[model samples]
Target: MSHLLELFRFCPVCGSEKFVENNKQSKRCNSCGFINYINPKAAVVAIITNSEGDILVCKRAKDPARGTLDMPGGFTDLNETAEEAVIREVKEETGLTVTATRYLFSLPNTYKYSGLNVPTMDLFFECDVQEISNLTARDDVAEAWFMPRKEIDPEHFGLASIRKGISRIVGK
Candidate 1:
């Protein structure tokens, strides 16, 4: 895995090549005394279930893990709350307008993107959508469907945190 510190050849604040590792989690610009912390990005995961107790699942249309089972979610945008992000992500990926969300739990994950292993804190939420009648896959989802909780196999989910979450929810 490529270290995030290695990616920073220059300091953002001073545009100096003196940016070096300040510690395990940050890079410091010796020229201007600017330190950039390598913090995990915040992401939201929506666990939506149908009235019949089937779980909503999406097929990833893009890689990191394309053609695999996933939940509707994405990284939170700047200046947005986690709740808002979940609602937005659900709509963008599943065409479902989330009416309510209850925070569940969070897990650490390593998302490989652009040849870099980006760390993320994935927050899980139990979301209620307005309706599933119009649940068409959109955005980065190739397809979306609901499976009975008993039929869900955690191993089918490519992401580690998601697999764990599904296991916990299904008691599998």
Candidate 2:
């Protein structure tokens, strides 16, 4: 929030230069009384598993965690539901079409991108994929593969939320 306060010097609503911190999560414009609330973004993650119980993981191609393992998912787009986002992200990153999604859990995350720490609520789902045999890495993923649960290491995942998610699954 300190960074956000530093970044936003002008009021977005009135174009006033008197924007000031109103609270921990918001800023207020002295000229127009407009309050800007900083909210966490919505993201989705798919817990894809093969029939043998191996978990699907992707190698991140870009930074903030490049070259590390991640689940197949990303931020939800405008006007899109979390379920739709999960399915779309899975297809975009792993070339696997999600036929169904079952909500599993959620975790708070801070994604550092372009020098900004973006807060996010990561929604997790167990997804059933179609044509699982046709897996190919795409988009921000450099590689995608399934690994046995026993061989999974949470420490190998770059993101904190992903590591926690992996721990939860491996502990199960």
Candidate 3:
């Protein structure tokens, strides 16, 4: 939350040079009286399990946790539902189509990117892949693989929300 205030020097609504912080949640424009609130972004997190109960994981290729373990999901685009976002992200990163999904949970997380702490609400879903075999990593993923649930280690995940989500998903 502190990151949002620090990044904005002027009011976005009125372009006024004078902007005042009303609280940790919002900023007020002195010129136009436009109030801006810091809202967490919506992101989808996949908990893909195979017939053998192994979990699909992606090796991140970007920062804020590059080279670390992540699920096959990403931020939602405009006008896309959470379910649609998960399906699209899964296909984009893993080259697998999502046949179905079940909502599991949501976790709040902070992603630091380019010197900004981006707040995100990670909406988790148990995604069903049409074909587990012959999967390839793409987009921001460098590699993709599956591991037994028993061998899953949340500590290996780079994001705090991912760690917690893995723990909850694997019953650890």
Candidate 4:
């Protein structure tokens, strides 16, 4: 979030935060003629399904959709493969060990947060849980559960990627 960056006065070009917004989009460093362009972050998540054909969803513990249900996924780490990120996110959020079967689809969505454009390229994967027990929420997740596709409320879901993933899987 840009607000998080505002706490610093170092120029991004020279680690100096003495900068000001030129108009409404670009930032200019007073010390140096350095201009930094803000960009969006990418996040990856899984649409995990059990043998019973129920899709896994977690209650978000953070904003953008706090308390809303979403698939177990988040920002992809540096140097981490999409598959690795999905598997790790699923386990971290739901406490369920899973193996990624395949990538479902990639969705690009944008939302505003902290006065900055938060755009995300959400990479969705279809995964199968190895063992369903020992479930507890972690990684900014309040709760996790499996729900039949037909029973999921669209309005309660955090993003369209989640809804689209469920629709695609259940339709097959």
Tell me the whole-model lDDT of each prediction, alpha carbons only: 0.93, 0.92, 0.90, 0.74
For residues 1-172, write the lDDT of model 3, one tens digit per residue.
2547677879987799778887876788889998888889899999988889999988999987999999889899999999999999999998999999999999999888778788899999998878988689999999999999999899999999999999998888
Model 4: what TM-score? 0.75
lDDT of 1: 0.93
Candidate 2 steric clashes:
0
- Sorted on lDDT, best first, the list reads 1, 2, 3, 4
For each candidate in turn, the TM-score is: 0.95, 0.96, 0.96, 0.75
lDDT of 1 by residue, 1-172 (tens): 4457687799999899999888877899999999999899999999999989999999999997899999999999999999999999999999999999999999999899886778899999999999999999999999999999999999999899999988988899
Q: Lowest lDDT 10-mer window, candidate 3?
A: 1-10
Query: Clashes per prediction?
Result: 0, 0, 0, 7
Q: What is the C-alpha RMSD of each candidate to the true structure, in Å?
A: 1.2, 1.3, 1.2, 3.9
Clashes of 3: 0
Q: Which ten residues in a row have the lowest lDDT in candidate 1?
A: 1-10
Q: For model 4, how does the per-residue alpha-carbon lDDT over 1-172 read when each residue is reduced to its tens digit?
A: 3542454366767876678775444577888888765565678877766677787778889887789888788887999888888788878887888854587677777655775456678787778878888768898899888898778776677776666665566673
Q: How much is 86 displaced in model 4, in angstroms?
A: 1.1
Model 3 Cα shift for residue 165 (angstroms)? 0.3
Q: What's the true lDDT of residue 61 in model 2?
A: 99
Instruction: Provide the lowest-lDDT 10-residue window in model 4.
Output: 1-10
